[model samples]
Target: MSRAPGQFTVVAPGRVNLIGEHTDYNDGFVLPQAIERGLRIAVCRRPGSRALLASDRGGPPLDIDLGAPLLAGRTDWGRYVAGVVAGFQRLGWTIPGFEARITADLPSGGGLSSSAALEVGIATVVETLAGQALDPVAKALLCQHAEHEFAGVPCGIMDQFAVTLARRDHALFIDCRSREVAHVPLGTEVAVLVIDSGVKHALGDGGYAARRRDCETAARLLGRKALRDVSSIEWPSLEHRLREQEGRRARHVITENDRVLAFKAAAEAGDWPAAGRLMRASHASLRDDFEVSCRELDLICDAVGRLDGVFGCRMTGGGFGGCAVALVDGPRASSIEALARTACAAALGHAPEVFLTTGVPGARVE
Candidate 1:
């Protein structure tokens, strides 16, 4: 195959939530890490008025005018790229028309941040082409805005932040309200595995949005600006003020944020057992109080929760259906996978895709 000269390659890694589910949108805390799997964006200047975008995953090419208005109602993957281009323009960067090809090893709905990888990868490519540099903070916030305004998912900063600023072999501990990030290393002899439940979820649907609304209502009723301001200590009294579901949502956010902080402390002290216990507790809260879990997710967690070498297992994404992560002994990783597959097939009528993963570096130019 003939290749164009000066074609730039950009890589943005996907992320898995180690803990802290559904806490991001509430301006709470999240522990996420960039994974080995990610998106690859290759680009070269076209020297014309339009930009051509195509993907190796089989979709029609998107031809966009360099000067056209950036619209928000797009319902396809191209919307992600268009959103980044629009973001660059909004940030006053000069981006020439270009031909770009996208490819990925990341699964779209496996609870990994595939969309953020695409958006950030394109933003990096655009910045390189424009001969300018955007700092990590600016890059993350910009891509987050792109998702909100263009992709129509009111996602939090955790995905973009982890994709842009993650460190190798470390999980990012971020306070969404403060935007402060800390990189905590994984201890030796520990392994992280993700088991894809073969279920996909769309966050734009009412389920995700409805949960966010409940949190907002909880905040308003408490006279606080956000659920982040409410302490877990106050949950007992606060639960009586709101309706059952709203109170449960508030309880999850406050308690989950606490779990993240405790987990971070435990991880820093090389206390894998404590960290694993926190993860199990977080999943229970998400399932019971938050009500974001589905049967498939429960099956994975229940099956893996009792394995001898397994430390903890819990559903890892925005919920309803997606992947679950398990922390286990490095040598026992394969055993856990086999156990999960057998148990899931017997209980859920299907087997899951289980694989091992580790924390890797964030997005960058290749």
Candidate 2:
């Protein structure tokens, strides 16, 4: 028999934000799905007091003391792994040595929340090894802890929280601050295709950091905690007061919030057209206001927009050359994929990776 060794595995899916974008960090609501591609971890307890984290992705595996300060590792991603260990310590769990083998199908910078997957995957495995089960809400928080503490990014709870809590073949409607969740059904007739530009994103990179700063700036100017606190009717009036700030940044959040609410209704009523149009507008806002989309993102979305069978397309994730999400009719999706591949290669000199996504359960064993 294979060496079980008190070992357990946890698989955590990567997420795609259907509409909500940068709004998550501002404590705004988001609609995300835990897609088919995800991170898988095999975690097993050992007799030692040391923890070992390893990935077969042509990088160094990390071995660190559990009780010490979480410091920078040989690689940047090591911090996220370290954060997961530290987070468990914060919970008063006595973590002995364990070995983790990590792998993911989600592209690193495709904006699919692969980092969040690593965090949650570690949490799920550790919790299982410790003879404990984390409530989905708590799992999300723990994963967020890794991101904020170890990863050193001031991120919102949406990505990790959504992947940990969302159900398969369903969408998660999350109120960022409250962390309240509603599971919405996905359309059976229309499918979602994620196109990866093979562009990687690291939020600690200044672009993501600056956007976080802008949201804080917006909150300060509006005299509220976040954009989510702004009343729908009062948003325009508040915007008139913050003349010192950029309109592009403020408008994206406000309008994206509106789109989320409208998309929810359209989704419930089986109005794919309304949902798809909102998606397109969301991308436009991200492009024009947030300035996160790159030339690659623009080109891919633009190509998909002109397709007759695609209801709509938009750049997903933190933008800056990640992936685009498209809603396509069942009959025409094959042609759409071929065109996207050709267009992306001709425009960017890279063939895109396209994924057909359906939601999956939060954490599972192989």
TM per prediction: 0.95, 0.94
Cα lDDT tens digits for candidate 2, 137-215: 8888888877876666778888888778889788899988777889989867677888897778777777887888887
Which segments of candidate 2 are over 4 A away from where they belong?
Answer: 1-5, 67-75
In model 1, pairs of residues that clash are: none
Best by TM-score: 1
Please report how far candidate 2 places residue 47 from its true position, in Å: 1.8
- Alpha-carbon runs more than 4 Å astray in model 1: 1-5
How many angstroms is residue 63 displaced in model 2 relative to the true structure, after the best TM-score fit? 0.8
Q: Name every residue pair that clashes in candidate 2.
A: 292-320
Clash number by candidate, in order: 0, 1
